[model samples]
Target: MNHTKRSGTPVKRSLKVALVYLLVGGLWILFSDAAVERVVSDPEMLTRLQTWKGWAFVAFTGGVLYLVMLRQFQNDRVMLDRQLGQQEEIRRLSQFQQSVIDNANIWINVLDPDGRVLIWNRAAEEISGYSSDAVTGSDTVWEKLYPDPDYRAWVLERVSRIMAGDEEAEGLETTIATGHNGNRTIAWNSRSFLDAAGRTAGSIAIGMDVTEPRAAESTLKARERQLRTIMDNLPGMAYRCLYDEYWTMKFISSGCRDLTGYEPDELIDNRHLPWVDLMFADESDAVSSAVDDAIAAAEPFSVEYRLRRANGDIIWVWERGRAVEDDGGMVLEGIILDVTERKQLESRLSEMATLDPLTGQFNRRETDRILQEEVTRAERYGRKLAILWVDLDHFKDVNDSRGHAVGDEVLRSISLRLADSIRTVDTLGRFGGEEFIVVLPEMSVDEAWDVAERLRVRVADEPIRVSDGDPLTLTISIGVAVYPDHAESAEGLCNMADKAMYQAKDQGRNRTMVFSQVAGTIESDKSGEA
Candidate 1:
């Protein structure tokens, strides 16, 4: 278009003139000598013009004719050369493009709006396992390439819209079967191609095998879903907090509401009361230290403390958190969990382990622990301490005759009576079976004896009632021991009191004996006092 006009007509005038000049030059050369001689001999011709002038005219005319023919030939040669150069360049470019397409790793295909293959490249040949001879000028591509005809139709519709100039075709990726055997899965990105007139020519598609990447992505998505499910359904609050004075909540799961009476959104980003605000002021330093240690060491930590609830109720809570660090060893992550229920359970279990379940009183271990602590206190404060051990009289007769259920009831009754009998400051625990022990702080032997007699009378006077039938009367024998005077340690005090109790039981039972002497003598023996 740029080189010249596009008419097919030849240069008629130029061609005729060139041929005529050639013929005239040949005829002149053939007859020029004879013709010159005849003109010289003519008398009339001599009168009008000389022979030499005629010869000069012939030479000039012949030369002009030859130059015109030569000029025309040179012009044709120039145009021919230009055309040949252009054709050669076009052929080289076509070869280069073919080589590129053949060697490319990207699979490429050209399709018409009807999902028919139009121009399939060499890359497509290698990938789809189909050659141009097999696929071109045919619609077999749709049958094999598009496993789902409906999906193919949907894509064709969209592509048609693009072809119609309704929209610019952009990346449209979808999974499809590809490869030489037609079993490989690949991801395809398709777009429409426009022709010289801005009209739809066909569609161009580029594809890559992404089966492995897609599988890995699917696995990651599944794991994310599982973690989300666990976090959403956990029984307690789990959260991440910033290591600051506020211990601000950074990420809190949905379960936060159940524990703190605040929604997850309310607590996140320090919107609601933060950890520092919710904790007891006295325990804040301890909480901070625990967190610091954990963060410094990238280890787990736990703290037992009190939490102030939204309703202003002080409730005990156990907080546990672990630190997560970056590759550079910086603590960039934190996980916090609510352990309130667990702490409450631990306290309850400790109580159960150390104290008798039925009596709600300290058991032997608890008694010994308190005795040791009080002995140290007594040594420091110079205060006197005493122990009084008591044994029930004929308590087993009630159990054996009436059933163990009644016996259990009797034990509970005795425990309650013993609790009521002791002073608020004094300590009492069911030692084992029907044996009871009492601890007195800053009390003399006479004071302890008075308290013991009071407890003894209370037990003897209380009528034991069984659910089966009738109420019965019971009695207790008492043995007294003064701490640090009659015995120096818990074991000695327990042994001396136990010996005294057996002596009271021996003196016909229901009697009080003081183990003040080595061969302890019975001081009081009243069977009918109650």
Candidate 2:
């Protein structure tokens, strides 16, 4: 926009003006001289008039030259003013462009074809901690930014390829050592410009600092690894799933293979099977209801249910979960643990509390409970109920001769035979040592007598084989009592049955007796079995 201004008119234009004036004045002089000669012949007078005409021509020519020079000067002034206004506009536009570049937030730098820094903006200065004065017209800033020789070489090569149009510069990244900050990562985009002749000129590169974003990405990846480790180490399946009947899985841990005999990928998205399909059909409704209720209450849920594995084996599982809000809407997050072993242990403990250890029949306490329940049911329905009280005959003599182990074996064998002789609806239990009770519901007194006779025969007809001795012949004495016939209450009925049992033992070692038959007997008439 700046150039030297000439002080006066151009030499070529001034010479052209002088030539035109000479031609016009010469023509006028020749014409005037010819006309004066033709009009007058006197020598002195002609001389005088010619002198005047010469003077007049000189004056007029002088004025014409003055007017021409004045007009030329005015035109030159107008041209000079226009040139000045154009230069001023060019300077204003250049200043505005510089201001925009300097105020931009991103780094902007330009390099010459020889790799010298041509332009560096304020942002580049702030980011690199090198002022424009320090970086412009020099290439040393590259060494400061890339302190490592190998890295610098790579960066330079990449930039060269980009400037040569051999490689794209979009999203190109580099790590630089900053003057103030320890280090920074930058993402760059670049373009090469051309001169007026379309020849390769310098290049401009724009960069954004990405150090913080890269650091955050690294931290996020590390935490993801840690979370994966924890999930893999867990003994149960950890999951995040949609709250639907399919329990569509979004994420499932590696422990799923061990828990359900299905891989995580198999269960995710119900690729193989829906989570609900793994539960027992009978228990699914109850489990679903429990989970739904807990979710409705905005509380956590805990449920124990059976699951069928991929191998088709059923196992008990305990699940604890809660509804959680997620990007995909409400979902379930939970853990499911195998609880088959615990359930088995609980079952064993329950059996121990209510079953006879040696005979595997209901124990005395459980028998009493059953008797009371049956009595209540029969009374409510006006149904007949009967009980048979059976006693092993001469069982103490066997214990005294062959040891208690053999005697226990005989008792167990006899209990089994008695149990086999009754209907499935009848309840048989070990009432005490050498005695058992059989409860029959909806049975008349005569029907009870028949069942008691069958039980007595069933024991006497078989030989009880003991592990320590040869098979021994065994017999049992049974006494029968009917509800509402012998007594009203469970306890009274039991007493009547016991009296009948003692009466049978007194009458014979192997027989049946009714409680009514022994009720009228004198107390002194009751005797112990021989």
Candidate 3:
């Protein structure tokens, strides 16, 4: 619009100037010629006036031309200033875009159709350790970045496929060598486009180094494999479980077989078997409560309990574990080792401490303890307990003549018979040479007397066959004492029973006597006063 309007201005100015000149010149010519003719008598004088009119016309035309050219120059100057302002705006906008790309952390590359660099941003220069002048037009720069020819060919082939093929490389990962760093892993995003003339413009790729992250991923994979191997080789199952009533197993190691006679498949995620079912029925509540308490306190624990295996066999085990509760998502993780052998050994050691090696009965220490306990129980319940002090008749002669081995054989036989004659709750133990004590829990003196008589008959009627000699008949004299009836204390009662046994010996060889028969105080000597 402005160009069209300006183009018409020169014609308008010419028309106005032409009109003015025509008007003024017509008047001047008409009047001036008349005046010249009137005032001059000679024709030469009239010609001079006409000449002056001609000079005036020339001067007036020159002045009009100067004003018109000045106006045109002013209009041209305004147009030029507007054009300059627009060009400055466009230049600033282009600089702003370039600055943004240069400061971006990622490397940017722009190439021509021949793969020669057309643009390499600041990041590219900083990372590649080369200035833009060095890389922008160098065809050999691509080779320096990726040294191997075959690798370059492969990359070019791939880039070609991406540019021309139906499927393009949206986000491609590749490796490149840095001038100083040797090698760098990169993730690239590239695209091929058309130029202004609609020809292929090669590709532009934006890349980021991923060397550290890739190395971390590789290390993680290796660590995971190593942990899995350790889990597989464990002697017992390593488990992660939910803090549920069943202590549901979420994950279990392959060593589940060695500990529970079950496969990992049977326990993991509680598929077919729950961990709670493995505990002994009587111990389940105690064990669960204990673990819950530990978790509540955020403490670690070690407890011993019985667990039942798949084959219905029960074994003892020691379990140590910790509870990790974060954000209230409770998870239980720990190892369960097969400590059955250790438990068995402990049980054997306990038995050895309390049982006699020779007669397989309660030894002296255990018998005394049991006697004291039974007495306390009897007193508490207002009931009676019977303790029998028994002696063998003529066992010394057998030991002296035959051998101590024969005496041992006789004693073992007597112990067997006594054991058979007593109640299940009774305890029998050898007190000393030819002396055995039997403790009957919850038995009255009358009941104890019957038990004593049964034992006496069983022993006397039974004969022991010596290894080298003929069979020897044995008779036992028993003295019975009732708890809190004969004497209130174990020591006093035992003394009374001892006196009763000696009385039986004094009366005859084989007999049964009750402590009430000699209710008086009995001395340490068989039957003397204190």
Residue pairs clashing in model 2 are none
State candidate 1's TM-score.
0.67
lDDT against the true structure, each candidate: 0.73, 0.87, 0.81
lDDT leader: 2
Maximum-TM-score candidate:
2
Clash tally for model 1: 0
lDDT of 3 by residue, 1-530 (tens): 99999899979978997898789888878987887788887878778778987787778767876787797789889989988988998898679648877777888887777878888888888778777899887668878877898998988887776566334565577788888777888888888888799878777888887889999998998998999999989777788889888888888888888788998888887888788888877888888888878978889867778878899888777778898875779888888888889888887898888877777777788899999999998889898888999999988899899989888888888888888887788899878777899999888877887888878877777678778779998888888888788788999878978888887887675788886644463322232211
**Model 2 lDDT vs. the true structure?**
0.87
TM values, all candidates: 0.67, 0.81, 0.73
| Model 2 lDDT tens row, 58-133 | 8998888789879988999998999999999888867865877778899998898878898888888888888899
For candidate 2, give the lDDT of residue 231. Answer: 91
Better of 1 and 2 by TM-score: 2
Model 2 weakest lDDT span, ten residues long: 521-530
Which window of 10 residues has the lowest lDDT sum in candidate 3?
521-530
